[model samples]
Target: MTGQEENGATRKGPTRALVLHPDLKSERRRRAPELALAEAVSLAAALADLAVTGAEVVRLARPQPGMLFGAGKIEELKARIEADEVELVLIDGPVTPVQQRNLEREWKVKLLDRTGLILEIFADRAHTREGVLQVELAALSYQRTRLVRAWTHLERQRGGLGFVGGPGETQIEADRRAIDEEVVKIRRQLAKVVRTRELHRAARRKVPFPIVALVGYTNAGKSTLFNRMTGAEVLAKDMLFATLDPTMRGVLLPSGKKVILSDTVGFISDLPTQLVAAFRATLEEVLEADLILHVRDIAHPETEEQAADVREILESLGVEEEVPVFEVWNKIDLLTLEQRAALLVQDARTPGIHTVSALSGEGLEALLDAISTALDDRRTIETLTLGFEEGRARAWLHEQGVVKAERDGDEGHEMTVALTERQRAQLERLRQG
Candidate 1:
């Protein structure tokens, strides 16, 4: 029987879900409970076949060990769940295995914590082989810690990693050894994917175009901006994690200079550590970026906090300090006229900030001009004299199209080339060898 079937009755339509955000007073760096709950509802909406019935913030002085909520509170939630016929409860916080088990028994419904929900979204959205493997690896790592005996029947009924619910056959409980073996297999598959990606990167490096990567909080308009700039139909939506895998497209700037633009997965506050580690390889585009555009949803209530989260993740990824970063304040179309005017004034005063509404194309001309100018600043024209023996270096300079002028010389040739810092370094290495 499918997971939707209960007591011989096949459930119809989307699974009714209730989202709860546990507001712990003792926790540091706490977000507004209402906002957290709202985000959770949005997250629930991101998953297909999950209709959120109700959502609220549950205040707690402290958490109960066995059941995240106190006995009385648990009973209260159970009554509400029964009344609403909620088949699934999504907790916007971590829940231990014991706590999850107890809550499932008490509430008589499937429960997923924030991490599980995020994994489900990723699994559902991940279209690439690398992305799928990474999600599976992260899910396996998470499941290894919370595996329950005789829960294989539950595993078969979910669309993604079997966390929520789908259709499949009943299976045996997954032992730790079995989980470990699966992990190994996924890692092997992922290594192959990474190698292929590395080859692609190497090919891009040969093209000599600067890589500009867009990164920001989820639903912060990175993909929208990318589509507006590159004219590519990448999925740009209001949902969280609309674009999971990294996408790259070549764009010709108004200055007639070409560049590769990369749109990456958006960052969120308190992202699961397992995913952070697992998706590191996926974010290598940012590492190789010549410039990073930190897109911000200026209209979001927690815009500053969201920007902070993106910076934190970028730092963790060890992006080079030398790579130039420009802040793109997006979504001005959602702001009031007065607010938008004020933002534009502030943006003018900021050295590395640009304001735009990717949806409405407001201020995009200026943003694109700024991008072209920023890329130009990375390059410098230098006159160099190469010996006859350095034929390879001369060929490379011509191939890069950095050679602005060249003249025959007594030894070999003298050339004037406009080269970016990376190109200059490569030229020097060639000369040294």
Candidate 2:
């Protein structure tokens, strides 16, 4: 029922939230604090039915170990929380166990740091089996560190444990042993899923189409662009982590080459090291991709930082440096006429950069052509001779549609074929095996 009220507006009762971002005043910050605070509010809203009642950027010259915010700010915010009847307070940075507990006690409300809020969003969005397992595992890892607080007598505190309950429970299902057991169980199940996925990947290797992966920070229009290109109805919402499961669609590029386009889970800054460790199966899609498209919301103020976060996650996943990647500047339709021209000039000056608005289908032709070129760049024509006994190689060539001409010569069948370096390797492996 959307948790709506009688006036047809969002109900701000228990779901009411105050988004507080502790902006560390640093010269090395990549984005403005206002932009960070706004992103925090967006993230809070992305969680399960959280209606942001208020938001603020709290400048922190230095972090407090016991309580994140000062006593004065805590008391003041407590009054606001009480006046507004806010049920949740989401801090847009890491909060130690002691800090979270103290703040929660002071505010008389639940609290979640950046990682906890993201984990909640992930858990809510995870639908596929592997995705569900990954989310649980990540949440368990986050929960392990947060088993207790300042009030050690309480054992496990309710705040900062990410989402609460299963199908329906009011408080976070937590504790050390519960989290440990859940983590182990999830790992076993995920291992099975990972093996199955490997078999699927092996089967995909037998197919000829190259795999192109779309990766970027959350809500950077990756799924939208994937839908625009592949005509697949993926859940392309304006919310964070809208697409949790990795989705693949067969896309025919402008060059008429069929390729598998994969839309993966979005990356975010400080994306929970546990998530990075647990979601390797989904990240492997990026590793196996013949080309990676770093989609960016060009209209966002933190576009550069978002792109950097995606790159960092990719690197952490051990994505090879040799993989050809294209910087796809998405949402150009949101730009002004002058801004679009500037973007075009910037894109033209870069070798692997393209600008496109996935929503409007603008500059898509050029983007498609770029995809074709990047995939085709690894191709080379070569002549190979296969005996009648080597019908498998001959059939594989025909399957790949890379054979330009084939004729039965005296000694054997000689044919000229065009294929990528990876394709050449695949052919060699087939011949050797």
lDDT of 1 by residue, 1-433 (tens): 1237668987678889999999998897546788888888999999988899999899999999989899898889999999999999999999998898788888878889999899989988999999989988888888777865222423555557676654322233536767778879888888898999878876666687888999999999999999999899999999999999999999999999899999999899889999999999889999878889999999999898889899999999998677889999999989998998898899989999999999999989998899899889889988999998899999888777678899989988999998877677678889999
lDDT of 2 at 366: 92
Top lDDT model? 1
Q: Mind giving the per-residue lDDT tens digits that candidate 2 earns over 107-198?
A: 86778888878877777788888988887777767766775532121232222233422122223344565656766887899889889998
Off by over 4 Å in 2: 1-14, 149-174, 382-433
CA lDDT, candidate 1, residue 119: 91
Sequence-dependent TM-score of model 2 = 0.83
Each prediction's whole-model lDDT (CA)? 0.87, 0.80
| Pairs clashing within candidate 2 | none
